[model samples]
Target: MSTYLPVSGWCYMTNDLMKEIIRVAVEAGERIMKIYEGDIRIEHKEDSSPLTEADRRSHEHIVSELKKITPEIPVLSEESADISWQKRKSWGKYWLVDPLDGTKEFIKKNGEFTVNIALIKENALAAGVVVIPAQKLIYRADINNGAFRRNYDGAETKLTADNNLNTDNLKIVGSRSHQSELMQTFVSNFENYEIVAAGSSLKFCLLAEGKADVYPRFGPTSEWDTAAGQCVLECAGGVVLDNAGNKLQYNTKDSVLNPYFIGMREYNEAVLSWFKALN
Candidate 1:
């Protein structure tokens, strides 16, 4: 049965709705995997980021499913992101999707890519679902509902970020593809920390599952790239703060590019200070 919580005027987050979103993400992942197992043709966008058939197929599947599930809600996908700001600025709630988050990782066949879906209400993350197609795992969260991780065999584990504030032995997750000089400088501030290199939104899931302590993203990312992961991490007792030390928001401006941010299990004055110093 579907249960809903009226979070704001005319906005609701329902358990059944979340389930449907997850299903959409999973089905999209299946489509991507089929292409992943075959000849992967690559293309480039205006920004030169790699694109593949898997990306387009997954985008089509997810967008189609989401529209069928909730015809009223709008959808903004990385593949079909040409929607004008004037058209999107008025959307009180919509689906923010990144059909293929780690195309590079997928091209490398590293099995670290994922399909991301998030619900944005009033420019805030209201719900999210991330499906790791290669690994057959899913992470999900919603407003007022705790986060959870579903395994391949239908097992689910409630996720909670590790509250360990031990900066001496912090496990910082970093991007496998986009590395920056600022990231190295930021890590130099840590006396004893190890880097957990990962691709796509799995970095956020690592924090949500208590597998990693923090994720500092010093490179470029879009709103769709982090919205679903941010919701999962935040719901699991974590936080994703922009350089300005505010929660990362969605669809706030004309450009979809997001500010550099940090995802951590809990608030740490030391980490925040370090980030501020670098910025």
Candidate 2:
């Protein structure tokens, strides 16, 4: 297999490097599982969200491996101490990571959490990988390169987002942790939709693979929460657009919080029209 991919106007990343990222993600997942399967201790951050040993182990392992792989590229991880915007704004290319994306799901043992890693080039997502630790599934993609899914059995399949607009039975994915009345009201616009409650970046992965049609997140999400999954989904022909129908961009502002957005396999005119009316 070739190690190099030509990405004009951006630093090229080798296939070997991508594979190493996948390997690192899997190893982090293993570390998370070891903590998941044992007696667990939980702590809380300033935000009052649950933090466990699994999250710390995974974060430490992933950050260490990424630094080893690309020491020149700075990393912004969920577990890392917050860097000042002045420093972050100076970075031309860097890694955005959430070592354990769904800590709530991890604590609940629902097997829905994921490890997210994204390459950000000049405020745009360049490449990404999402790892489902419990399932041993890995999804990845890069700019101009198509998306793929690797199953637990080691079989790989190219991924594509569903382009058909079937209004009769729309499948909408909603957040398991951050559900709110506003989101429910937004989802009510779909007349014949079924809500699929999901956690973390897996919602985007599901849309990328045609398992779900749309995901509307009206609640809070940081840049690291969505950047990796966005790359995979976008490469698979999906779109993650904010309420204004603009593509979700990263690192454009000092704050890492993301605006409410929808992940869609195919653009639905009716939904957008309604979304515009409401927003």
Candidate 3:
């Protein structure tokens, strides 16, 4: 029920949208910053993780402002918009967003939380934008068009993935705040690699910007969690593939839980075969 548009050049339009979207994301980040610094109360989600007023405020701002920017575009955000299976099945294109990622890190006051916004067209993520509120840094991408990193005070620089992961020279970036056992097992299988920890969607940024080389996730993740970051990484010449060595697709499953996947900087015959064996 959806149509695929040729992935052609559309930099001007995408950048314009990014400018507007950046405005909203930065504003929402400011809103969250205020709560983070003030005497705001932190609650827990139904799953019993820490949820603060900052999360709610940021979510509200992102959803309301994004709707104003693109009214026709449907949104699938972490805090809001739980689309039914029937309804989601009909969405050819949509905005897959997470206003406040790393709420636990936000609660920890480590200043690692980020605001994630992504555009999903067809089954793939078309664009990814990540803003670090405390640092005022931004990571953005529109594949074929380009991907770059910038900060409030810094100039933009192009992002590119490094093909330097081969045994001893390997670098593995794990969840900053949450690492699972399966992930550790998978990483241990590698002959030689240094492991790094990062929070929120920043792990994807590290891979995209060439800071880290590989990311393995054998635990549970949702569609909204990985959509934006995956787009950015893919644009930067990285790949986010499932067990079958295929890129993950959205809205096709009844449950939004993502299967195990690995994000790597470029393709490697050895690693690909290794993962296929793990499959």
Candidate 4:
């Protein structure tokens, strides 16, 4: 609903939206870890998704801080995003966020939950930040600039991937929590790739870090679920596309549920052709 990215306040690249997002998430994580440390009851939404007080706390904290820090930019958060397509279609730039990305892991107390934040422009994810609240680690990227991981030692390391990421052992990324039979068949179909399982938005982080190559998701996912991760993944030299091999767009469709998709590193015509053949 806004066109202020060009004339906006913060310089997205140098301004460190990553830092801001991480800061907010870490602050929210403080609250989440508090409840998580206790015997808090986890509730389930209508879709049977596990919900908890941590989710609401994180959502409220993220939304409040994002609005105050980057008030000029429109935001779509998984918890409170309801802007109509008519209004969002007019937007050239907006923030796509998932305040609590892994509620299931939160319920499972596996410490795999994360915070996801991304900026979108012209249907492309421009920048993203993913933070694991439990471990207090972060991975961030601004498109074409570079991707970075901030470990527990507070050291920031730049991420790099070999050009032949798809060639070697052929790392395949799949959801650590939820996996479908079809998804398994798809992975089983690939003889050259080694399958690896991960949870939450961290699957995309694996692709971003060159730890994995291909991520195929057959189940339903919301736009907020993948937007932030896709930004970091693509920035780190990867591609996340629908079965049609098209870049995923946010807020353009009436249903927020995303179709099946794949995440591949060093993408090219051959990979695109393979994806096309699957469709």
What would the per-residue lDDT of candidate 3 be over residues 1-279, giving only the tens digit for each residue? Answer: 122222234332255577777777888899999988878687887878677888788889888877777777788888875678898878877788888898878888888889999887777777788999999999888765667889976899988885666766778887655557566666767777787888888888899888888877766788888988888888888899988888988888788888888888776766665656655
| CA-lDDT, candidates in order | 0.88, 0.85, 0.79, 0.77
Candidate 3, position 250, lDDT? 87
What is the clash count for each candidate, in the order shown?
0, 0, 1, 1
Pairs of residues clashing in candidate 2? none
lDDT (10s digit) by residue, model 4, range 202-248: 88888888888878777779999998788778777787888887887
Model 1 lowest lDDT segment of ten? 1-10
Q: Write the per-residue lDDT of candidate 1 for residues 71-92, one digit (tens) a residue.
A: 7788999999999999999998
Better of 1 and 4 by TM-score: 1
Global Cα RMSD, each model: 2.7, 2.8, 4.4, 3.6
Query: Where is model 4 more than 4 Å wrong at Cα?
Result: 1-11, 166-168, 175-179, 268-274
Better of 2 and 4 by lDDT: 2
The alpha-carbon deviation from the true structure for residue 139 of candidate 1, after best TM-score superposition, in angstroms, is 0.4
TM-score of 4: 0.88
Model 2: per-residue Cα lDDT over 17-89, one tens digit each: 7888888888899999998888879999999988998889898988888877777788999998499899999
**What is the TM-score (0 to 1) of candidate 2?**
0.93
RMSD of 3: 4.4
> Residue 93's C-alpha lDDT in candidate 2?
90
Best by TM-score: 1
